[model samples]
Each structure stands twice: as C-alpha cells, then as structure tokens.
Target chain A: MTSSAQANVSSPVRAEKPQRKQMSDMTIRNLFIAPTLLLLIAMNVFPLFYSLYLSFTNYSAIARKAPVWVGIENYVNILTDPQMWQYFNTTGKYTLLTVSLQVVLGFALAMLVKEKFAGSGIVTTLILIPMMLSPVVVGLFWKYMYNPSWGYLNWLMGFTNPSVAPDWLASSWARKSVPGLALFAVVFVDVWMWTPFVMLLVLSGLKAIPDYLYEAAAIDRASSWFQFWRITVPQVAPLLMIAILFRTIEALKSFDLVMGMTGGGPGDQTEVIAVNLYRKAFLGQWQTGEASALAYIVLIIIIAISNLYVRYLNRLREG
Target chain B: MATIELRNIEKRFGETYAVKPFSLTIQHGEFVALLGPSGCGKTTTLRMISGLETVSGGTIHLDGANITWQKPGYRNMAFVFQFYALYPHISVRENIAFPLKAEGMAKSDVYKRVDEVVSILRIENLLNMRPGKLSGGDKQRVALARALVRKPAAFLMDEPLGALDAEYRESMRAEIKRLHLSTNATTVYVTHDQVEAMAMADRIVVMSAAEVQQVGTPADVYHAPANLFVARFIGSPGMNLLAGPRRGEKVELPGTGNIYTIPAPQREVLQAATPEGKNVIVGFRPEAAMLNEQGALTGEVYATDMLGAYKLLHVSFDSDTVVHIRCDRMVSHPIGARVRFDLDPQQVRFFDATTEKAIGPTQSAGTAPISVQAANAQEKAA
Candidate 1:
C-alpha cells in the first residue's frame, strides 16, 4: 500500500514547473537579504582594500607624498626598525595582560551578579559606570592621580621619603614603567567596567538554563566542582567565547590611555602601534608615507586577530 | 525504588500560598498524576518533592529517611521536563550519558548504557545528532531516553508531552505507558489534561486552588468527584448542573419548570444533610441523560458535536442554562428540533447549596458500578 501511494504521488512532486517556481522564489528571497549583505561588505571589505592600496603609496595627509610605488620599502623599514618592533612588543604585552585579567575578573563578577540578592542591581550599576565612561576621560583622570608631586597615587602609596618618591613621567624607570603602569591601570579600569558587561551577557545565558537541568545534575549526586565543570561551564561557554572575542578586539586597538597618560613616553617606551602610527603621521615631522604604511600594518594585525576570534566564534556557534 | 512521602507540604511565594498543606505518599512502582488546571499547584508540588523549591512548612521523606533539607541531587530521582531540557550543544548519546557520567561511571559503561537506551527508544540513527537538529517528537524521545537511562529511584515529569503534536502525543503516551510497565519505576506525572491523566495514571490526584481536592483511581475520581470543581474538571463536556429546591418527594428546577421525583432513601439523606425547601445543585454525567419519546422536560437541540466514536447533542432549556447529552456518532440530531429527555434519577448527584459538595448516597447509574457512598460521607462532613 505504501509503495502504491508513493508511485502515484511521485511524478507530480517531480514536475518541472514546481522546480522552476522554487528557483524563482529563492531568487526573490535572496533579494530581501541583499541590503544586509551589501552593508557588511561596505563596512568591512572596502576599508581593507583602501588601506592595502595606501600601504604601498607614500600618501600622507600633511606632507601629501605623491604615492611613488616604493614596493615593500616601508615594509622593509618598519620590519627592521627597532622602535617599530618595540611598539609591536608593547602592544602584544598589553593585549595579553588586559584580555586575561578581563576574562578572569569577568567570570567572577558574572558569577557574583548572577545570584538573586538585595542591592545586586546597585552593585551592577556601579560596576558598569567605569566602562561606559569615555576612555580619554579615564586616562586623563588617572594621569592626574599619578601626577608625582601632588598625585593621589603617590599619596595612596604612602611615600614618606621624598627621595624614594619615583618620577612617573620623566626618568627611564618612569618611561618604561609608566606606559606599562598606565596600560595596567587601563586594564584594571577595563576589568572594573566591562566585567559587568560580561556578567550581564553570562547572566542571561545562565538564567536561560532551566532549573531542571541543574536538578538533574544534582540528582546524579554531582559534586560542586563537577557541576561547575560539566554543566555550568558548558552552558556558559558559547557566551564566554563571544565576550572574550569582543574584549580581545578592544584590547588590541588600545591607544587612548597610552596617549593621554604617557604621551608615548619618556622614550617611545609605551608606544603601541596605534600611538606609533599617530606619531609618524603628525608628531614625527608629518611623514605621511610611513604613517600610511604603519596604518596598513596595524590593520593587518587586527584582521589576523579578528580572523582567529571569528573562527573560535564560529566553532562555538556550531557546537 | 523509593517511597516518597510528603507530610503537609506547604509553599508560599511572597504572600500568596501556592500550595496549601498538601500531603501524599507515592508508593514504589506506582504511576500517579497531579492533575489540575494551570496555577493549581501541581507543578509546585512536583518541584517541592524534587527539592527544587523550598517548602515553607513540611517534611519530605524518601525511602524512610527524612530529606526535607537535602538538596535536589540528594533526592536521587530523574526529572523529565516539559521543555525536554536536553543540552542543545550535546549529541544524543552524550545527553543520555550525562547523568551516569556525572555519577563518575566508567566511560565504557556509560557508552553501553547510552546504547541500550538509544535502542530502547529506537533513536540509534539519531545518536550522533545534536538536539537542535532533531524534530520535536525525536527530541521528546531523547528526553525520555535521557531520564530513563539513569534508572534512578523515580521519575517526575512535568507535562512532558505538552509540546508534542496530537498524533505524536498519542504515540508518545502509549510509549511512555510501555516504558513504565517494562521498568516498573515509580513515576509522578503532572498534566492539566484529564484525558492524559485518565489514560496514563494508575491514580489521579485532583487539585484546585492550591489544595488537594481528592486522590483516587481514575475510575473512582470520574465516577465520584468529591466536589463541584472535581466533577466539572475530570469529565469531557463536564457534568451538567441544575440549581433547584428539594421538596419532600420531588426536586423542582424553578427557572425551567422541571421536577424530578427523588428516591425515598436519597430524600431522607438529603433531609438529614440539608433543611427542607432549601436550594441545591444537582449533577449528572452527560452519558446518563438519555432521550426518550415519552419523557419530561422538553428542550431544543442547540448544537451537535460529532466526535467520530461518540456524538454530543447540546440541549438548551427555556432558561439560559444548557445541558449536553452524549449519543452515538453516526446518529444525527438536527439543531433547533425539540426533544424530550429523561434523567436517570439513580445516576444524579446532589451537592450542598453553600459548600458545593456531594450531599447524599448516589446509586449506581449508566455504566457506573461503584456506589458513591464514600463521596456522600465526604459531602456530609463538608
């Protein structure tokens, strides 16, 4: 009976007109998706090519260097320059330090805020204020706090000895350490501010889990540690990965704090790639060609990091 | 297997009592249903037993040990949720293996048990797929399989089939019954649908307004509902009710001008329970109301609902109230046509005007075999 019914209905289903109609319908469906596709391409793709083209040309906003095709000259110079390498190393250290602290502190804050309690809303609101404040304002405020003489940092550190009170913006110690300290300060501020963001996202993710799943886990007589590892972590991973990716992107592009606090420092010791690019463009005698090349280099590094983050995001989504 | 005992379990959220002094003992290997409408404390009772919700005042005992303060895991029972609660990221095999793995079972044994459950649920082909990719019925089977694989003390399910399509729910209902029979596991199922409760539960615990109305076998509850709420709740087309006065020998409906001669014994019981010339509500099952050529109380057929196997003819009186008469499916009754119907006086039930509880001894009527003596005693007490 099944075979006879299948035999009767098979031909009509396989008819050509239905197939043609489906194709046209799909084309019309694709038309609805076109705007989003074009927007994404314009925002992400066009800038990439524009920067790539600028890298080979000596295009400067001030010097207005007519782009002579100096194939890889800027690349060769920037690759070999010790100062450029110094900036790369500085940027890498900042990214690693900031992202790690953000993740750990973010996880802790998320866990704390996830539970229902009195005044949790106020705590969350207070914690989130630092992140929402402008980066430039935060850097300026910290600079005032670390102003060496009347600085709050010195006062807080309790420097009774006038001789031992270290210079924050002048000496070699100040140069190397100030930028790193400022970056750490920014990272601390980032963790303070954005940890709540991570908490909010993770809180929603945690709440989404029906209480029955945890009950099931408990009925298995799972230990506290075991439940955290198996159920809690697995449930929170997808959102955590997304949060980490967002923080990483923001950390790699860190520039405002270093600029406002150290001003690329006692001797270019604190200059990240973004700050270096700024210096080359305007401060270092308006070397537009070198700045364009440096800009392209920063763009390349960001693209590589973003690509890695996107791959992890895609894998998390799939799982 | 474990015997779960609840001693006057009460729960309150803020100021409102969600469950009021609920008490019951679930025997080992028995299938019981907490059946009621939404917000009637059925799910709340199930959660309290599972230790997911804290009881305001109660003691919970499982297998002779008081576990009132114990956490959910210490209760040693598996719960299949209405949402399935299958981790969407995990494969079907892992979802089934989760409880065993959490208990630190060996890898080989976990795999073997997963395989056993997969075969039992006929989901071998779907073992490698994630829950997000499965159909609704398939996901339901996976949830059932996951719950059963643990073979814990008992299973508490909250409307597990509520999300399935009608055909799938029917098939799953049969499958769940078979699963229960094969395993002989104690199960507590919650549902608003009386049909589901009647079809699946060995005993149905009827609840309403944060209180347990009655607990009995499906046949017992259907034939002898304790109050007006249970009577209307447990039956399809519900029980037809008419408000009237019980005179010495006959009860007369004032608005419809219908008088029913009361049996002498029932009249005596009614007299003892209530004052003479007092108003009372009379109730009867739709199937008990039969149409006869030579009967009293003429009414016009308002509507006919054909349900394949049985048909219901809704009859309306000159008064605003209506009563449904169950009849054969193919036996067509035209709407707007006048029909005379007789009430099987023996099958009728009387409830107190103030309390709405069954008031007197009800004789066996229609296909009902059990005398509602217990219900009458309860009504008298009420």
Candidate 2:
C-alpha cells in the first residue's frame, strides 16, 4: 500500500509534460545567435562599408550639395599633400617613442613585481589606475600640470633655477623642428597612461612561464644573466610584441590627449594623424571627404603594421 | 661523479612539515630513486639535494664538502623536469648548447658538444626543430640531451617519464636506465610510480607523510617491507594483512573463525615483539598463498580477477575479511566456492599492530629492508 501511494505521487510528475518536437542543434544555435549577429551588422558592419563609400566621394557635413562621386580625387589630394605626410611623420614618431618607452619601463616594472613580497598586490592594483583612466581626463590634468606660469611643473623646475624655467607650451625650440620638446611632453603623457597595459601583458606572460624552466636553466649552470637572455626575454617576446602592436596603433590614432594637452599649438609640433584628421573633418572648414580618405589610408597602414607584427608573433610561437 | 649527502635535512611551513628530518647518502655513480605517493615529500627531498630548495635546517654535503649554501647554478648539477621544460624559442641544437654557451665556450666547441649529445641520444634528426614542434617522446629526448651535454657533476630527474603515455613510458624508462648505465653519473630520480622506481633505481627510498618509511633495493622492498606502508605501497596488488589477537601458539583472526599459526622461523620473533594478549598483523604477498588440499586455512571465494599471467582469487574467510591469492591462470573459481590455501613460511611477515612496524627477523633471505626510518615520526605519514 505504501509503495503504490509513493508511485501515485511520482507518476503524474512524469506524465504532466507532453512530448514536444526537439529542435536540431544547428537551429537552436542560430536562433540564439541571430540577435547578436543582426545588431553587429547594423552597428558595426554598415558603418564600415558606408565609410568606405564616402571615402571616394566629396561630402561635407555643412555643405548644401548632395555627395558627388569624386572617385580617387580626394585620395589623390590627401596622398599628395606634404602636410599630411608631416602629420604621418609625427604619428610615426609618437608611435615609436611611446611604444619603446612603455616596453622598457613596463617590462622592468613587471619583473620587479613578479616576485611576491608584502604589498605587491596593492602595488599592481594601484598601477592599473592610469590604464583605467580616460584619455581626455589624463590630458586635461597633464595640461594643468604643464602650464608655464605657476604650474606644478614650473614650480618644481624652479628648484634647480628660477630664471631658466622655460615655457613649456610656447617654447620656440619645440615649434622649430619635427618631434621637438613639446612633442616629447605629449609622448611622455601617453607613455605614462599606457605603460601599465604593457606591464600587465608581460606579467601574464611571466606567469605562464613555468618555474621549472628557470630551475632547469639554473641546474644547467646558466648564470642569472644568461637565463634572462636565453629564457626570460625569449619567452616574453611574443607578448611584448603584442603590447607594441597595441600601443603603436593607439599612439598613431591619438587625438584627445594631444588636443587637450597642446591643441596642436606652438605651430602644430605635437599634431598626430588623428588630431590633424579631427581638425580637417570638423574644427575648421569641415573637409570631410579628404578626412575620410586620410582615415582609410591610416586604416590600411594599421592593418599592414599589425599583419607584420602578427606574423612575427606566430613565428615566435612556433620557433 | 658526485656523492650527495643529506644529514637531518628537513622542510617546514610554519608548524607543519613538508618533509621531516631525514638522512641519506647517495654514493657516486649510484642511481637512487626517492619514491612515494604525491604530497609524500619525495620531490621536496630531491629538490633539496639539487639546491633548488633550501633546507629549513641542517647542511647538505656534496662529495664531503658543505655546499648547503651554494647557488643552484654553481652546483653544476643537471635537472630534467617531468614536463620537459625545454626553451620554447630556440632550436633543439641551441637548447643543448645553452649551458656550454653560458660557460663562454667557443661556438665550434658548443656545437661539438651538442652534436655529441644528440648522437648519444640518437636524436640528430630533431636538431633543427623547436621543442614545441616535437612529440612528447622527442621533447623528453631533447630535455635529456640538454642535460647530458653539460656533463655536470650529477643529474637529478623529477619523474622525467611521468608525462608520457603508456606506449612511450616503457620505452623512455628503458632509455633513461640505459642512459644512466652509459653515463654512470650519480643520479637522483624522484617518482611515485613503484614500477618506475623498481625498474631503474639501484636503491628505492619509499616515503610517506613527510618522512622516509624505508630505503632498500627494489627486491628488498618487495620481498621484505620494513613496515606496513611499504608493504601496501610496493606491489601492483599490495600485501594482504590479517589482524588477530595473539594467543599462545596461534593468533585468532578477527571477523573469521580461523586462526593463523606463525610460520616456524618467525614464531619466536613475532612472540617476542608483541605481548601475549596483544594483537599482531600477518602479511603475505599474493603469490605466497599456495593451494593445498589439507591447507591450514579455508575460505569462500569472494571475487576473482584474471591478471595476464595469473588469476587472482580473493577468498573470504568471513564476511569482514578477504585475502587475495595468485593461482594458475587456467583454473577458474565461482564466487562463494570454498578454497583451501596455506601460507608459505618464507614469504610471511608480521607487523606490530600498534606501531605498524615490521617485527624483527623481517626477511627470510637476509635481504633486510632499509627503506624505513626518519629522525622524526610525530608527523609521520601524510
């Protein structure tokens, strides 16, 4: 009687749900993925193709005329301009300076913090604040610090000598040459903000390297310096290359930092490609078509540079 | 050649021990294996000898010199890791030459050393490949080549074949033993595999619970375990133990009506070790139980397993006890069938029930086990 009573309770639970046709795995997968796929096509892919089309046409944001198909004229104009070349040269300088300094300082910092000691976790977390910061905020604060009169930098510079605290924003030497002292000021800010990114990458790479490799190397009688050259450096190279790739592109497209800090002032010494593109498209006459062409040129360049680095990265992995 | 000595060396984390104080002397050109289960401090002992781990107390002597504080690099010993930690960014040739290059040898001499090692390992075809591109076996061979190229004072291996599949493990085990015979470099190997330790080691150091349980040759550990742990640890199917209260001439087995008669030779030793009313444990290898019509013990067949060369019959003398016995593979026994078997006097051993240590006169062939003992037992088996 007890067994029949228990069976009476459990049987209806099984019978309550009627059999339903099952969905195939592929159909269910597509059903779940369609929303995300459509959103991506609308938000990202459409804009990308639209921009590619606009790159070949003469279209201005404030103009009264419809966009006219100019075919390669805007591309030709942007490519032939010497000032655009100068902007690219400045972008190249910025990429090179920021990437190199960030790699060196970041990798050194990673090594220093790799060995755990008291408060090391706190140090790592604290260093991530700059990388977490918005570029515009960093630019504004650094701009305040770089002010010539009664600014924090000049106040500190007055310690060495009062009379020789030169103007940072208005120095003639900065405006006289490409990538002069004023450009270095902005480069310094970029490096300050992004060095932690490289540090985190190298830290992860260092962590992935097994302790046994170093043990094996030590047992092989390889000196600490030898181990660094043979094991640590080579082991972390691919990650370092990835860090370089990220920073190079970011530095090339730097707009807000240079705009907030220098505003391409002192006669455009610190104008990177992105800042120049911003000025061309929106600030002055709104040359949107030429700016669009220039943007595509920069995009192609980024792709080429990334392709090279990725190839090198793959080789490092396989080698 | 190098002789490594650890005298009362130990490791501790706060109040707990990773390895309690223990001492052993590995002679020059001898292959010694520190054998135990995971977390048994065998790896820690091997690391201490290699100077990769600093001893919490006591000094380590290398060839009669106190090299306890020496840097691991300056120790001039080669270590092969279990996972084959080859330098991933270099060719196998550069990997083998890494140490020689560090020594500031000329390029030609470095290449010559690398070539010599590759030829010795018969891995010349893999010279140009990176370690990531090699198979597990090939990678291990490259790691071995790297270690051998330096011709260091000694070699330390931490379960070097533990990562290989069964197909490669046997061949690599034989290859490593062959390498040892050819080099005759004093080697310290750490492994938890009894088969590995038994096959290659000149001396096996069986460890448990952060202490050395026993140290003996493979045959000694198998035939005459120094304690119950070694008896349970050394064999594929470990020794069968029957606990009983010791009576005048026979021990009354628990959970069974039968009584065990102490084999004639060890009766005096067994009686002397335990009090008259105290309990003793009888131990025997599976092969030591012989089927006889007028056998001393009778039990029902509890289970049966077909080993490759023999059938293992588990006999239940009562509901609570089952004893494994090896019989001819051609014979079969149904479950619950009565089988009579007698223990071979030569292979029987007795342990004190309280201390879990073997009684004296532990071996029949005089090949006594030295695999047991440590300076401390408060933190015995972990």
Which candidate comes out best when scored by TM-score?
2
lDDT of 1 by residue, B129-247 (tens): 99889887899899989888877788889899998889789999999999998888889999999999999998888888888887777876787676789889989978888777778
**Residue-wise C-alpha lDDT for candidate 2, range A223-292, written one tens digit per residue:** 8888888889988999999999998888878888899888887687888889888998999778778888
Clashes of each: 2, 8
Error of 2 at B331 (Å): 3.5
Off by over 4 Å in 1: A1-54, A58-65, A165-200, A203-212, B254-257, B330-333, B361-382
Candidate 1 docks with a DockQ of: 0.39
lDDT of each: 0.78, 0.86
Candidate 1 residue pairs in backbone clash: A218-B73, A219-B73
Q: Go through the candidates in order and give each one's DockQ.
A: 0.39, 0.66
lDDT tens per residue, model 2, B142-161:
99998898887788999998
Candidate 2: segments with Cα more than 4 A from true spot: A1-60, A66-71, A159-163, A172-179, B254-257, B362-382
